[model samples]
Target: MALARQLFNRRMMWMLLGCLVVFGGIFGFKFFGRYMMNQFMDNMSLPPATVTTAPVEQQRWQTRLSAVGSMRAINGVNVTTQAQGEVKAIYFESGQFVDKGALLAELSALPETAQIEVLEAERRLAERDFKRISALYKKGVATLRELDQAQATQDQVLANLAVQRATISERSITAPFSGQLGIRQVDLGQNVAPGDPVVSLQQLHPIYVDFSLSEQDFSRVKEGQGVELTAAAIPGQNFSGRITAIDPSIDPANRTFLLQATLQNPERKLRPGMFADVAVKVEKFRSVLVVPRTAISFAPYGNAVFIVRPAKSALAESTNNKAVAPSAQAPQWIAVKRFVKTGEERGDLIEIIEGVREGEQVATSGLLKLRNEGGVIINNTSPLPENLNPTPDNS
Candidate 1:
């Protein structure tokens, strides 16, 4: 009985030791988790270790709108044949630069020429007979009725000659305007019918840029306004133009108006059908405040920007009564939420129409870590990260 009691006691002691070990482990894990959470809070609550800033400078701000459109030629035409006949001669080659009234091609004019010659000879004979009859009638050798009949016959022949000459001219094809010609649709000796397209011609020196704007923008857009255009075909190069025409009436379906601009394509580099990025400056405000796009937080209610004030020092010398604290309560380290009315955006900078005033420094780089009344450190000496430029990868 004594041995059994000793064994039972030993087992009870081992069970007690196991429970204590388990309890200690649970307590340790709970304490460690709390300690880690506190450390994380301390780090996050701390102001951002570093930041970059830009001075809010006063400069002229332009309110402009941009749109995408396609380029077109100012004057373009498709040359067609007016007379149906066998192509006798092609005066201009395919893709030739032709002058106004220059002969582009000709139909078989032999038959028309022969008819003109016959009519001319008959007209001459008719005139001679009419003159002789008039003289005879004056001398009383011919009757008045005979002189009248001769005069009528001469007039009829002259009219016939004129009609035949016009027919001859119609057989020859001439360029109506000076332009560059496209590929020839017909070859020499090929029979062409009336209304058949001979070639295409376009004057591309002064090209046309056509873009549409909403009715809200139409009133602001005026004739003679300058436009800047860039094409994807020739990247980095901008073509300048001026608004030459605007539709007075708005399209009910789209609430937009068509705008036509004429650009001087001196190099003939801009081609029709190329895509363009068009910008029109509608208003210019002088000495306005401007901010980076990254600084602005666009929300449904309104746009907001966070301004950063300097943090206070805590050193004995720095803790003077006049010195401010480095906390949120400190006037020196403050986060101001300003609602800004934004205008046109160019690159990464946006034009501020109202709200935020000039010379206020805003938090730009570390927006993800910012709050309404969070503390911020202005490290203006450091450059803003290149990735901070507002974009989804333009390059």
Candidate 2:
């Protein structure tokens, strides 16, 4: 019995020691996990993000009505032949500038020239006969009927001569107006018919641009309103002109009115059929709150901007800690995302209608790394552009 009691006591003591070790291990693991979590939380505090910012401004913005337009020459037409004949000579080269009534081409006028010569000879003989008859009639040698007959014969010959000359003129093609000619459509020895296109001519100086605006804007627009034009074909250049004409009636099919503007093209750089963007200065300037377009974070749900301000949490911590001087430590700023109402957009700036005030600085760059209440540092060494009218670099 003594031996058994001793053995039982030994077994109980071993079991008790094993249970204490298991419980101690479980509690120790739980404490260690808690400690690790605290360390991770401390490490998760992120540093401030560097960003560029700009202050919201109040600017005088002019109202403008915009539309797409097409350019046209003041005078454009296709020069054609007036009579049918074989082309004998081409006087002008392709793409040449010619004056009005300048000869372009000449058809084979050999037959017509021969006929004119014959008619002239007949006219000369008839004139001499008429003179002789008139002289005799005055002297009473020739009768009145003979003088009248001779006079009639001379008039007939003169009429025939004029008709032959007109036929020759019809065979010669000339420029109807002063302009530049396009590619020549005919060559030497090529037969052409009447009304067939010979070449295209266009008076390029003082070009016209035709555009349309909504009928609602008809009352707001008038002749002499200033217009600014930019074309995709000619970038970085703007042409200015004034409205020259407006359609009297609106198109019933589209409810739009046509507007025409005249621009001087002394260089002839603006060509017909080129597409252009037109902006008509419609109203006087008005003051409005504006911001750089880059500052806004556009979203389908709502548009927002990050307004920078002092971080309250950091300020409180600094206040509590007397050892850390406010001046010694770098200033802390936080980006607070605020929804905004935007109005019309100009070149690089946008009108802010609501949710922001003038003189408040908003983050312009590094927006993708930003979040609400996130830490930020303002670094405006390289700021984004905010021009009202931005131009492309020639390079």
Candidate 3:
């Protein structure tokens, strides 16, 4: 009985020891996790971290709206023939410059010319007969009906001559305006019908830019306003013009208004159908705060920015009591996350409409690692893109 009791006590003691070991392991793991978390928090609260920052600026900001547009000719048309005939002579060369009334091509009008000669002869004979009949009727030598018949015959012949002359003129092709002509579509002796295009004539001295503005911007747009344009086809070249027209009605489908501007393409660099980027200056704002786009932090709650206020030590020493803090001097830069409301954006810059004032510094780079009320050292090693208007990549 004593030996059995000893064996039972030993088994119980072994099970108790196993439970203690498990409990000790749990407590050690919990203590280690707490230590790791404390270390992480200490690192995050370091005195200063490097970041790029720029000062808030106040300037006369020019509000501009951008849109895509297309270039068109002031006067563009395809020169076509109005009558069907065999092409006789092509007087113009391919891609030639022509003036108004200049002959381009002529169809075979030989048959019409021949008929005109015959008509002329008949007209002369009828006129003579009419005059003779009129004289005879006045002397009572001819009947009044004969005089009327002769006069009617003379008028009929005159009408035939006019019709023949008009038919010949229809076979001739002429430019309707002064412009550079496109490639000729017809050759010598090539039969062409009515509505056959001979060539394309385009007046390119002054070109028109057709674009549309959103209905939200309708009230700000007006005729005679300045517009700047750039073409992706022609890089590094900018064209300037004044708004020549603004549509009186809004487009119900897209809720936009069509506008047109006239630009002088004197060098013939601008071509029809070229895509253009257009910017129209709406108005100017004075003493408005502006900041680089990099400084903005977009979030679901609201847009915020990391502003660099003076460290606790600097604030304590500052003469202005408004910047003072109750804590002791900590001699390091502080990053204060401030929620801001921004307005229009142009290129890489944005207008700060609210929640930020001029002369304050905002972190421009290294913002992804920032925390609210964190410490940041100002480092401006790299510069941000600063363009008032930027060209967009079509790709």
TM-score of each: 0.65, 0.79, 0.67
Model 2, runs deviating above 4 Å: 1-43, 141-149, 300-302, 313-331
User: Model 3 Cα RMSD, Å?
Assistant: 6.4
Segments of candidate 1 deviating more than 4 angstroms: 1-58, 284-343, 347-395
Residue 253 of model 2: what lDDT?
100
Candidate number that wins on TM-score, 1 or 2: 2
Q: Which TM-score value belongs to model 3?
A: 0.67
Please identify which of the two predictions, 1 or 2, would achieve the higher lDDT against the true structure.
2
Question: How big is the positional error of residue 335 in model 1, measured in Å on the Cα after superposition?
Answer: 16
How displaced is residue 265 in candidate 2, in Å? 1.4
Task: Kindly report which residue pairs in candidate 3 clash with one another.
Answer: none
1-395 in candidate 1: lDDT tens per residue? 99999999999999999999999999999999999997766544455434456656466755666888788987788888888899988888887889889998889988888888888888889889999998999899999999989889989988988887777777788888888899999898898888898889888899999998888887788999989888878764668889999988999998888898999997888988888999887776556667777788889999877766554332222322432224444334545556788876655677778876678777777766665455666667766532212334466
Provide the overall lDDT of each model, using Cα atoms, as 2-decimal numbers. Answer: 0.77, 0.89, 0.86
lDDT of 2 by residue, 153-240 (tens): 9999999988888888988889988989999999989989999898999999899999999999999999999999999998767889
Ranking by TM-score, best first?
2, 3, 1
Indicate the worst ten consecutive residues by lDDT in candidate 1. 311-320
Count clashing pairs, candidate 1. Answer: 0
Better of 1 and 3 by TM-score: 3
